[model samples]
Target: MSVIDDAIVWLNDPLNWTNPDGIISRTGEHLWISAAAVALGCAVAWPLGVWMGHVGRGGAAVVTVTNLSRAVPTVALLTIFPLTAIGFGPKAIILALSLFAIPPLLANAYLGVREVDPEVRDAGRGMGLSAWQLLRKVELPLAVPYLANGFRIAAVQVVATATLAAFVNGGGLGMIISRGFGLGLASGGGQVLAGGMLVALLCLTIEGVLALIEKALLPKSLRRVKHRPPASVADALPAGS
Candidate 1:
């Protein structure tokens, strides 16, 4: 049968849809776990990133640590989690993906804050703005685009990496793929491919929605065209001087 036909069959399969045992329940559970991990990662990373960027201190250290955390193989890390201690299910995968998420979130937060123009900051300070006031009124508004971008990236990563949960026997769409692969569907792994495709589509949809949100959140001024200064003499002439 064609791939589409195979996918339809797989989708209609009663065995695939029903939450028999806790295994079937894992799909929803894993998605929840991944979301929680992303949320937790954002909570920790965003503030630290914003602070580092605003203060212009410890950014390199933060980046280094985040990078190092990202570099750790997630599967290996998941494996290292003591099954005896934590058992299986969502905890191990959440820990794994949370670490995976931190680098991008932190990096983006730092980049967002750092990207704010010094002139704007100086103007805020000159207007008698306190540090917190400056952050709230000036830096944060400017940094939001980059921050949102970071969130988008982190969100996609979380969705994709969520599949790794299956290795630990934690559920999600990965369970579908895993089971399909093991069963070797009549269409030659088409079921697994279909399951994987569903995940890809979900990620794409999430990214598109987030991009729209980022666009909405950013100011029109920031969204406007950024033109380079004209060359030399003509550009230097004052408008009315």
Candidate 2:
């Protein structure tokens, strides 16, 4: 039978979906792990990023870490963490995934606050607003869209990365893929494909939720505005010059 046909058969088999270790349980595990990783990442990154941007300091430090984190491969970290005392299971995976999540969250929050109009900052100051009040009322509200976008990036990344959990004997749809790998091309390739599809679907679902949240909380103008492209060299030159 075709791999696609095999997958359909596998999917249709009620026995394959028994509660404790089935797709349903695996997806639940995936969601919680991804959620924990993202929550921890945002908690660490968002406040520091916002505070630094508001103060107009730490941009260099923040970007340096963001770049460094991006450069570090996820596989390397996943492998290394298990060797430490954290030693396998969800904690190790969660820690690795959370680090993977931090760069976007931190960078976006920082940029969002920094990008707020100087005139707005001045207006807030003019209103006898304290530093805390300015950040709370003016900067944060304006920065919300960027923050949400950062959240979207972080959450999607964590969900996708959590599939690697099965490598460390944690849990997720990767189990089915790993089993398929053992069964070879003829019999179980469909299992691998199905596993991958589940992960992709999870990622899409996360992105959809984030999109809805962004739409509900932010106006269209503010969505993803932090990532404007640079002007071309011609556009950079003064018109008269």
Candidate 3:
């Protein structure tokens, strides 16, 4: 049979679709685990990022640590975790993905805050704004765009790295690829290729959705700043004159 025909057969097979020990079910669980991990990572990273940016301290340390974490291979980390822990599953995958997410979030947030114009900050001070008020009203508003961009990046990374979770016997599209590889070894290579293709398609779809969200969430004023005219000489004259 042709490779396409074999893939079609495997995809349509009832065994693959069944939730229990089925490819589809396992993949869904994997996605959920990755999503949860990304959520948790964001929770931990965002506040720390904001605080670091506000204080203008520990930015370098945080970035260095996160970069180091991301540099560690996910598969190697997953493999090592099982040695420490009895089972390999969602927890391992979550830890791995969370480690992967920190650098981008922290770096972007720091850069975002740092990029806020000094003149604007000076203006806020001149207007009798406190440090906290300046940060909230001036800095954060300017930084929001960069913060959102960081989140968009993190989301994509989580989705892509999620497939690796399958290697640890964790669920997701990785399960399909793993199963396909096993079947290929036992029989032929058709199923492996098909499963890998499906995962790629899923990643592409996720990326497109995130891109749309980033565009929608970005501030319109940041994209196009409207300039107000200076006060007129007529208006400057006394009201009773």
TM-scores of all predicted structures: 0.81, 0.89, 0.82
Q: Highest TM-score: give the candidate number.
A: 2
Q: Evaluate all candidate structures by whole-model CA lDDT and list the values in order.
A: 0.73, 0.82, 0.72
Residue-pair clashes per candidate, as listed? 1, 0, 2
By lDDT, the candidates rank as 2, 1, 3
Off by over 4 Å in 3: 85-88, 185-188, 223-241
Q: What is candidate 2's CA lDDT for residue 206?
A: 85
lDDT of 3 by residue, 1-241 (tens): 7777777888788887785867677667756876887788788877777778877887557645754664678888777776666456667678778777776777667766776788988898999999889888988888777677677677778878888877877778777778778666445466776677778887788778876786687767764212211111122245553
In candidate 3, where is summed lDDT lowest over 10 consecutive residues? 224-233
TM value for model 1 = 0.81
Q: Model 2, range 25-77, lDDT digits (tens) per residue?
A: 88888899889999999999999999988998987777567657767988788
Best by lDDT: 2
Evaluation by TM-score, superior candidate among 1 and 3: 3
TM-score, predicted candidate 2 vs. hidden true structure: 0.89
